[model samples]
Target: MRIITGIYKGRHFDIPRTFKARPTTDFAKENIFNVLNGYIDLEDAIALDLFSGTGSISLELVSRGCQSVISVEADRDHHAFIKQCLKKLGTDRCIALRGDVFRFIKSCHQQFDFIFADPPYALPELPTLPKLILERGLLKPNGIFVFEHGKNNSFEDVPGFIEHRAYGSVNFSIFSNREPEGEDE
Candidate 1:
């Protein structure tokens, strides 16, 4: 995987053949960051990356200047690889956690300015992730949450849905904590 821009721009990490995680493609990752750039500032923002495969997004977050990032991955080897990557980058901004993403969400009491999730597309619980995270109060007011899934899933009808973007087979559904403008309480 390669970081497309920011401090770590052009840096690449080789994923082991034994790994099962699918790191976001450079094309998709770049485009998503471009979309996010228009919505929020990563500078000093606190971020969360759930199902953080290869810690690709987490590393990119730090490279772009997020003050802190928490990366949660259920796979032990993936978690270890993420830590190794962070260490190689000499950055302490990202904390790699080896645990269940759902459990972490349920137990997390801290809010974040940005949150990203890239769970396995075939996972049965993929559809419920957005609602679960939003309902848990994980995002600070106006904060954005980007969930990546396959093209077969759609989140436009979901509450808090802001927009959806598709890059090849990868799909991203963005949500925000604040209600849309012009709506009465």
Candidate 2:
């Protein structure tokens, strides 16, 4: 995988073949960030990355100068790889944790300016994530959440959903914590 922009632009990491986690496609990731750049200032954002496979998104956040990032991964080897990647990046801005994504979300009290989740497409709890995060107020006012999934899922009817973007087979449903004034709840 590669870091597409900012300080770490063009940097690449060789993920081990044993890793089962699917990293985001570089094309989709680049396009997603391009869109995000129009709305959010990455330099000032505090971000969260869930099911942080290979820590690609988290690393990209740090590279782009996000204020801080918390990356949560459930698997043992995946977590280890993330740590190693962080160490090599030489930045104190990201905190990598090894734990269940759902449990972490439940216990997390801190809010973020940006959040990204890329869970396994087949995971049964996928549909509930957007609501869980929104209801729990994990995202600060005006914060954006980007949930990545396969072509089978759609978040158009979801309350906080702002827009949906697709790149090949990758799908991203974007949500915002702040609803417009006078809009229905």
Cα RMSDs of all predictions?
A: 1.4, 2.0
TM-score of 1: 0.96
lDDT over C-alpha atoms for residue 157 of model 2:
86
Q: Which residue pairs collide in model 2, if any?
A: none
Question: How displaced is residue 97 in candidate 1, in Å?
Answer: 0.3
**Residue pairs in collision within model 1:** none
As a whole number from 0 to 100, the lDDT of residue 23 in candidate 2 is 93
Worst 10 residues of 1 by lDDT: 176-185
**TM-score against native, each model:** 0.96, 0.96
| lDDT per residue (tens digit) for residues 1-185 in model 1 | 98877898888899999999989998999999999998899999999999998999999999999999999999999999999999999999999999999999999999999999999999999999999999999999989999999999998888889999999988999999875578777
- Candidate 1 ranges with C-alpha deviation above 4 Å: 179-185
Global lDDT of model 2: 0.92
- Report how far residue 91 has shifted in candidate 1, in Å: 0.5
